[model samples]
Target chain A: MDRGGRMTAVVPTRATAPASGVRAAARIVAAPDGRGGTALPVLDGAGPLALRRTRAVAPGTAQVTVVGAMSAPLGGDHLSLDTRVRTGARLAVGSAAATVSLPGRCGRSATYDVRLTVDSDAELCWLPEPLIAAAGSDLAMTTRVDLAEGARLVLREELVLGRAGERPGRLVSRLTVRLDGRALLDQGLALGPGAPGWSGPAVLDRYRAVGQLLVVEPRFRDRPCQVAVLPSDPAEGEAMLTPLAGPAALVTALAEDALMVRRLLDAGRQAAAAAAG
Target chain B: MTITTTAPANRAALLVLADGRFPAGGHAHSGGAEAAVAAGRLYDATSLEAFCRGRLDTAGLVAAALAAAAAAGVDPLLLDEAADARTPSPALRATARKLGRQMMRAARACWPSPVLDALAAARPRGAHQPVVLGVTASAAGLGPLDAAHAAAYEAVSGPATAAVRLLSLDPFDATAVLARLAPDLDRVAQQAVDSARLALDSDVDALPAASAPLLEIAAERHAAWPVRLFAS
Candidate 1:
């Protein structure tokens, strides 16, 4: 059960989720707390799973980490993950470290799809470290969340262009996020080549960096941002976006009191400052 | 006791899903057509049709089913959460919520169903496009299958229609694209009806996983635009 039967130890297992390959995998670990809360289970030996010990961990700070590629991963082998935070549970899962790797060939990419569900009176935070797509590599990832009545979630994800010594321009990354059934957040980009928007005002504008965070909670509605950053809260959900600026267009909306101000910035510096807050 | 009138109730559900004016924020988005045009990936109706086809086969199909289910009296918020779990692109998810909000607005305006008000109250969860579509269709009295067809058609149409203004495609050709997709619309609609009957825990993995990578890339690239006209 190895490649061409040449190897014997790495056979794919039936216990794994369907469409899963050696490149990626995911699992859930949770046990109810004596008082009614629950503990998050570690995912596939990837690292420690983060769960709410009390109502103490701020909303936007949960994070988790999973190991990156070890050897040359083949096609059809991609990561799949799912997590559930039950009623009255609090959790934050962040990665231990950034993912690094030897870039794959052109036109090849690794895929990761994660599904998380939060129930009433529950809060979950996922602020994982950045993923480093090596030179000439392409990475495609999708993360989805389902929140029940009174549920809350805060998710943060980032990607670094080319790792270490590779030229930053040779990476391709695409990420999509959906809430409920309607397409909430969908974006994917392939860098390199004559990809029209390469230097255009309507595309990346030569920026090699991008980051996103989405928080869903009713409590987030009235909170105001002082400086660029908003502190994590238990009652509300917040999605704070930080663009590299770098000539790329910035589109954002922030609510103040009863009024919300949303504007686009032109320079990377201003965008960075705005993102920081 | 012979018969008074049931037209209003019969059409109530259909009105909820069919109206594009819903508060789901779909108006702010032109699908990827706006971004594709801005990126120059799309130049005319032909390319626009191709893009629509890809989306319909993947995201469009899912959104259609989810909405149709919601229309059939399923919980819109639950459907919204399920849809959210499926979308991976942060930007795309944001766009969906924006469109969802818009759909709600339209729904509240034209069809003030108690269910819609309840759904709206479940704010910040971001009512997805399909769930709202489903709930609205149910309120309108449209059959589940028919609702699915219309939902799919609209899902695909939104982007194709946007292409008209974004790429200078002849309106006639755009209409033709819509007309041509009729067969696909029916086929997918039937499939959705059948799939809806499956147990929630039934073999979802056995079903084909549909995804459109290129469109996703286009969306990501679209997010960074400095002066782009499209929201997603």
Candidate 2:
């Protein structure tokens, strides 16, 4: 199929050939259409990146769901997702399924870079499915968000070390969130192989699933969010909500499974939104 | 640190600055050991060593890098912001600043440098402890490596000492944990200096941002505890 001048196969095969891996960039741009709804001006997807406009529940929010057309981000593949939420607009980007990284013949690591931008008076909800790092696969994922003044953001990041009954490959994830030219949160977490002491008492401590929720609300400029320990659901492990130095608050949680982590983080998002209002 | 302040960097200065009894307000904090103990994650010497090892590599690496950057002559204000960007827990951030303020007082009195005084003036509430430690190291005529070593050592030593008190484990076992971690501390300090050198040439964003989420969550939980032996 011809996707924006690039010849990409509509349905990718499962041959797992390292040489045939495609490097692609997906783009999504959302803006208000002046009719009390949001518009998607640029929704281009190629290769394994399949971007589809989903039904957004909010009044003026546009939702885009990423559907992987192929079993990728295998080793040696380079993928990028670039998104922009224009002024007075809202965007929620999610994924259809969990992305599982696999080892390819190339024996090199894969890279996934996601860049999100929100303009003044705009909002972005970036909640994607968990990323599972399979055994023998190495991937480096980076997500950077740039928020203009008066912009609000709700971002969720979750990582599962490996599938059940298997060891995990090395996965390094870097998250940098900036608001109005100032940094809100910047953290690099390395798990599985190559990261010594990650599963020790002070770190994961036998927990395999980890996630966090970051809420950047301009309302926090006046009265800051109070730091509190999030009450854990009986199934979950531990979580906390702490106000950032900037106009943001973060909820960090660790659990035995991805479902529990997401539950804790979703509860955190509600608390943040309710507090902001 | 020495008889004269004009002399070359005194080795004892690092000893004094990094001393557990330096009155830097670190004694009240457990570096997450208290929470780990309360959670039963750390109840013995072996588990305590493992916990300290994790802290040394994640939080320890970041702290050492920030301190090294400061001691390398990077702007303290800029480093302070970088520290904030790396620290996600409000309780942890507050503890760092409070410790920074106390360290500032001690550093200004001991080293008496204009840089220390200026940083203290800029951050009245106080800067991050690592950044202040870097500046204090520079004031004492030490270098970035020295600052990194001090910070890295403190990362393990604080938890070890606290584990001794909290777990009531043998004191010698605690010191042995630190001794076994000496080689790891050296390696982390070296890596921190390299990162600091890179940041000095480029920007503070180049510093390490390694994070341990359990530590952050535990710290916040400990902060909210109705009654606790440790402040954080």
Best by DockQ: 2
**Candidate 2 per-residue C-alpha lDDT over A52-77 given as tens digits, one digit per residue, 9 for 90 to 100:** 99988787899998998888788888
Measured by TM-score, the strongest candidate is 2
Which segments of candidate 1 are over 4 A away from where they belong? A1-277, B1-28, B124-126, B199-209
Give per-residue lDDT, candidate 2, residue A236: 53
Candidate 1, residue A195: how far the Cα is off, in Å: 25
Q: DockQ for all models, in order?
A: 0.05, 0.76
Rate residue A123 of model 1 by lDDT: 72
**Model 1, range A1-277, lDDT digits (tens) per residue?**
1111111122212333233334445665443465554555554543122222223354322234443323323223466677777677677776544543233323345666677777777777765655545555445556656666566665655544554345543334434333333333433444434232232222333333344445454543333222232222212211133221011112222111101111111122244434334
Cα lDDT, model 2, residue A92: 92
Residue B31 of model 2 has an lDDT of 94
- In angstroms, give how far residue B151 of model 2 lies from its true place: 0.5
- Candidate 2 chain A weakest ten by summed lDDT: A1-10
DockQ, computed on Cα atoms, for candidate 1: 0.05
